[model samples]
Target: MSELKIVDTGNELRLLGMDEASKLLGIQKSTLYDMTMRRAIPVVKIGRLNRFKLSDLEAFINQNRQEAQS
Candidate 1:
């Protein structure tokens, strides 16, 4: 068996571009852009472009996750 390790960058977090963000979220770029326009997705404004933090995207996924409890 092999050991698994996660690399942490301390206070530095990686940011993703629109293309990468859309792919990670499994949505079309247009859809993501539309969501951003409506403030449905979390994003950061860099000049005139949109930027997404990987951590924020992860949180968004968790926030929208649905599970049934018995």
Candidate 2:
């Protein structure tokens, strides 16, 4: 099997687990799942798991902020 890698998007970091991803967004896991179901957030799916990148999360936040400001 191939190894999973998370390269620097200008910063060193690894892929985030569901727990970390939810916490990063300051939302509960259930809420995260709800958002995913609503297609409000992007995710990386490996097999039956969900993963996220720090940069993508940041960009998501930025995009939401812009939308809210508009």
The TM-score leader among the candidates is 1
lDDT agreement with native, every candidate: 0.81, 0.76
| lDDT (tens digit, per residue) of candidate 1 on 26-68 | 9999999999999988899999999988777877777777767
Q: Model 1: which residue pairs collide?
A: none
Q: Model 2: runs farther than 4 Å from truth?
A: 1-13, 66-70
Tens digit per residue, CA lDDT, model 2, 1-70 = 2322434666445678889888878899998888877878888788988888787787787666532243
Q: In candidate 1, residue 13 scores what lDDT?
A: 71
lDDT minimum window of 10 residues, candidate 2: 1-10
- Deviation (Å) of 20 in candidate 2: 0.5
Candidate 1 off by > 4 Å: 1-11, 68-70
How does candidate 2 score on lDDT?
0.76
Q: Worst 10-residue stretch by lDDT in candidate 1?
A: 1-10
